[model samples]
Target: MIRDLARSVREYKKVSIITPILISMEVVIECIIPFITAALVNEIKAGCGLNTIIKYGVLLILMAFFSLLFGGIAGSTSATAASGFAKNLRKDMFYSIQNYSFENIDKFLTSSLITRMTTDVTNVQNAYMMLIRVAVRAPLMLIFAFVMAFVMGGRMAWILLVVVPILAIGLGIVIYKTFPLFRKVFTKYDALNKSIQENIKGMRVVKSFVREDYEQQKFEAAAEDVCADFTKAERILALNGPLMQFCIYLVMIFVLSFGSYTIITSRGLDFDIGQFSALLTYNFMILSSLMMLSMVFVMITLAGESAKRIVEVLNEKSTLSNPENPVYTVKDGSIDFENVSFKYSEKAEKMALSNINLHIKSGETIGIIGGTGSAKSSLIQLIPRLYDATEGVVKVGGVDVRNYDIETLRNQVAVVLQKNILFSGTIKENLRWGNKDATDEELIEACKLACADEFISQFPKGYDTYIEQGGANLSGGQKQRLCIARALLKKPKILILDDSTSAVDTKTDAKIRKAFREYIPDTTKIIIAQRTASVEDADRIIVMDKGTINGIGTHKQLLAENAIYQEIYYSQNKAGDQDEN
Candidate 1:
C-alpha cells in the first residue's frame, strides 16, 4: 500500500527526496548549537578572553542562520511534494473511475467514491508531509541529543535508556487502541456523505412530501455516528500528552537531584555546573523529539485506513478492456444474442436476462414491450455491451462485442436511455457531445428531427440557452427530446430509445417517430415503450416476461397469438384510452 501511494509522487520525486535531506541537515546544525553553548559556558567559567567570547558568539549566529535556512527549505519542499502527490492521486482515481464498467460501479457507492477522493486523500496528504519531515527529524534528533548528553553529562545520561522503553511501551498501547477507532470513523464518513448527497439531490421531493423532520433525523443519525467514533478515538489519544509529560518531569527530577549531589560531594570534580546545564538542554531536546514522535504516530494511525482506501481505488483494474487486436469498424447495425444469460452479480438469485436468443437484421424497426422488472431495458443494454453477458456470446455487426474496439463499437450504437441527463452547458454544447465539431446548422437539423426545434426556438436564447446540472431548468419532455436530438447528431448505424419518449405527448411522440422514418430510414431503430400505439406501426414487436422472451411477432400477429401481448394491448386500448388511433 505504501508503494502504491508513492507512485503518485511522479513529478515531485526530486522535491520529496530533497525535503528529508534538508531536514537532516537542519537537525544536525540545531543539535550542535547546545554543545557549542556548553563550550562557551565552560570558557566563561574559566574567565576566558573577549576574543574567545566573540569567536564562540559568531559561531552560534552562523549555526542558527544555517539551521533556519535548512528548515525553511525543508518546509517548502515538503509542502510542494505533498500537494503534488495529492493532485496526482485524485487524477488517477478519477481516470480509473472513467474506465469502470457498470458492474464495477455497482460494487462501490457514489458517496463512498466521493469520500475516498476527497477526505481520504486529504488525510493521506497530511500524513505524507509528516512522514517526510517529522518522521525523519524526530528519530535523528533523539539519537543525536542522547549521544551529546552522554558526552557532556556522563553516566547519568543512562537513566534515559530506562525512561525511553517505558515511554515507548505506553505510546504503543495508546496507538494500538486508538487506531481501530479511527479506522471505524472513516467508514462512517461514507454514511455522512451519502446523507448529504441524497438530501440535496432530493430536496424538492423531500419538501413536497413535508419530510423535513424525518430527513433531519436521518442526517443526525449519520452525523452522530461520525461524532461518536471520533470522540472515542480522541479520548484514547489524549493519554499521550500526560504520559509524555510524566516521563519528562520524572527524568528531569532524577537528573537534577543526582547531578547536584554528585557535584557537591565530589567537590565539583565529577560533574560541573556547565555539564549539568548541558545535560538539561539535551534532556529538553530528547523529550521534545519524543513528543514530536507521538504526533507522527497519531497521524499515521489516522491515515492508515485512508491510505488503504486510496490504494484500493488506484489498484482496481477496469473489468472491460479491448482485446489485443480489436476490430476497428462496425459492418452494419445487425445484432445477435446467442443463448446469452446475464445476472448483475454472482450472488444474484436470478439472472436479469436469461437464455436470451434473438436476431435483429440491419435497418429493421423493432419494438419491445414488457412489464416492470421484466428486463425490457436489460435486453438492449447488451447491444452496446454496457454489461457483458454471463454466458454465451453477444454479436454486433457479425463480430463478438469483445472482439471490437470498445469505442469503435459504441460509436456505431447510440442509446437514449430512460434517464435523460444533460450537463450544465448551452444547447449547442449538449448537442455537440454526439459530434464535437458539429456545426450550428447540423445541431438545428438534429433538433428538428427529434421535434425539439420548436420549443428550443420558443426560448429567448434559442440554442445558446444554458442548461442547469441534470437538466433541472428543463421540463421532463424537453429534456428527453433534447437528449434524443443529441443522440441523433451522432448519425449512428443503430439507435435504441429505451422508454425515452414517455414524457412527451402522444402527438409529439408520433411526430418524432414520423421524423425518424422520413429522415433516417436505413438506421435500425429499437423502441421500448408502454404505449401500444408506439409499436403498432413497427415491423415486429417483442414481449418479454420474467427474464425471457414470452413472444415475438408483428403487432397484428401478436395481438392474435400471444396471450401477454393481447392482455397489454386491450388494457391500453380501452374505450377512453388516449392512445387510440
Candidate 2:
C-alpha cells in the first residue's frame, strides 16, 4: 500500500525528502543544547567569570534559534508535499473513474467513491504530514537524547532503556486493539454518506410522500452508527495517553530519587548537580519523543483504513479497455447481434439478455416494446460497447464493437437514456455536449428536429438560458425535448431513444417523429416506448418478453400474430376510446 500511494508523490518527492533532512538537523541541534547547558553549569559552579557565562548563553540562544528555523522549514515543506500528493491522488482517481465501463462502475456505490475522494483522501493527507515530520523527528530525537543522557549521567541511563520495552509493549497492544475498530468505523462512514446522498437526491419524493420525519430518523440512524463505531475506536486509543504518562512519571521518580541520593552521599564526586540538571532535561526529551511517536502511531492507525480504501480505487483496473490496435471509423449504422447473451456479473444467477439474434439495416426505423425487466435497454447497450456481451459478438457497422475504439463506436451511436441528465449550464452549453463545436445555426436546427425550439425560443434568453442542475427548473416534457436536441447535435449514424419521450404529449411525440423521418432519413432510429402509438408507424417493431424477442414484425403484422403485441395494442386502443368517450 505504501509503494502504491507513494507513486502519487511524483513531483513532490524532493520536498518529501527535504522535510526529513530538516527534521533531523533540528533534532541534532535540540540534543546539543542540553549538553552545552550542562557544561556551562559545571563552569559556573567552578567560579567561572561573567564573560564565560555570557559566551555559553549566547551559544545556547544561537542553537535554539537554528532549531526553530529548521523546524519551521520542515513544517512548510511537509505541508507542500502532502497537499500536492493529495491533489495528485484525487486527480488519478477521477481520471480512472472516467475510463471505467458501466459494469466496472456498478461494482462501486457512487457515495462510496465520493467518500474515498474527499474524506478518505484528507485522512491520508494528514497522516502523510505527520509521517514526514513527527515520524522523522521522534526517532532521531530519542536516539540522540538517549546517547547524551548516558554521557551526562551514566548507569542512570539504563533506567531509560528499561522503560522503553514496557512502553513499546503497551503501545503495540493499544494499536492492535484499535486497528480493527477503526477499520469498521470507516465502513460505517461510507454508509452514512450513502444515506445523506439518497435523502438529498430524493428530497422531492420524500416531501411528496410526507415522509420528512421518516427520512430524518433514517439519517440519524446512519449518523449514530458512524458515531458509535468511532467512539468505540477512540475509547481504545485513549489508553495510549495514560500508558505513556505512567512510564514517564515512573522513569522521572527513579532518576530523581537515585540521582539525589548519589549527589548528596558522594559529595559531587558522582552524578553532580550540573549533570543531574542536564540528565533531567535529556530524560524529558526522550520521554516526549516517545509521546510524539505514540501520536504518530494513532494517526497511522486511522489513516491505514483510509489508505486501503484509496488504494482499492487506484488499483482497480477498468473491466473494459481499448484493443492494442483499434478500428477508429464506423462504416455505417448497420447493427447486428449474433447469439448474444449477457449477465451483469459472473455470479449473477440469470442473464439480463439471453441469446439474441437480430439485424437492422442502415437508415431503418425500428421500435421496441417491452415490459419492465425485459432487457430492452440491455440489448441496445451492447451496440455501443457500454457493456460487452458475455457469450457472443455484437457488431456495429459490420465490425465487432469490441474491435472498434470505444470512443469511436459510442460517438457513432448516440443514446438518449431513460433518465435524462442536464448539467448546470446555459442551454447552448448543454446542447454542445453532443458536439462541442456546433454552430448556433446547428443548435437551432437540432432543437427544431427534436421539437424543442418552440419552447426554447419562448424563453427570454433563448439558447443562452441558464438551466438549473438536472434541469430541475424545466418540466419533464421540456427536459426530455432538450435532451433529444442535445443528442441530435451529435448527428450520429444510429440514434437510440430509451423511453426518452414518455413525458411529452402524444401529439408532440408524433411531431418529433415526423421531423426525424423527414429531416434525417438516412439515420437509423430506434425508439423504445410504452405507448403503442409511438411505434405503430415504424418500419419494424420488436416485442420483447423475459429477456428474449417474442416477435419481430411491422405494427399491423405484430398485432395479428404476436399475443403480447395484440394485448398491448388493443388495451391501449381501448383506453384511448374510453378517454375520448
lDDT of 2 by residue, 1-581 (tens): 99999999999999999999999999999999988998898899899999999999999999999999999999999999999999999998998889888988898899999999999999999999999999999999999999999999898888988988988888888888887888888777888899899988888899999999998898899999988877887887788788888988998899889889887789558677788988999988988888889889889888988999999888888878899999999999999999999998889999998889999999999999988889999988988888989998999889999898888888999999999999999999999999999999999999999999999999999999999988889999999999999999999999999999999999999999999999998899999999999999999999999899999999979977998988788788987456545
> For residues 1-581, could you state the per-residue lDDT of candidate 1 as single tens digits?
98888888999999999999999999999889988988898899899999999999999999999999999999999999999999999999999899988888898899999999999999999999999999999999999999999999888899899888888998889888988888888879999999999999999999999999999999999999999988888888888889888988988899889988887788558678778888988888898898889889989888888999988888887778999999999999998999999998888988999899999998889999989889999999988888888998999989999999999988999999999999999999999999999999999999999999999999999999999998899999999999999999889999999999999999999999999989998898999999988888888899999999999999989987998888788788786244444
True-structure RMSD for candidate 2: 1.8
For residue 247, what is the lDDT in candidate 1? 87
Give the Å shift of residue 479 in candidate 1: 0.8
Off by over 4 Å in 1: 264-268, 576-581
Candidate 2 C-alpha error for residue 446, in Å:
1.0
Clashes of 1: 0
TM-scores, all candidates, are 0.97, 0.97
Question: What's the lDDT of the predicted structure labeled candidate 1?
Answer: 0.91
Q: Which residue segments of model 2 deviate by more than 4 Å?
A: 575-581
**Could you give me the TM-score of model 1 versus the true structure?**
0.97
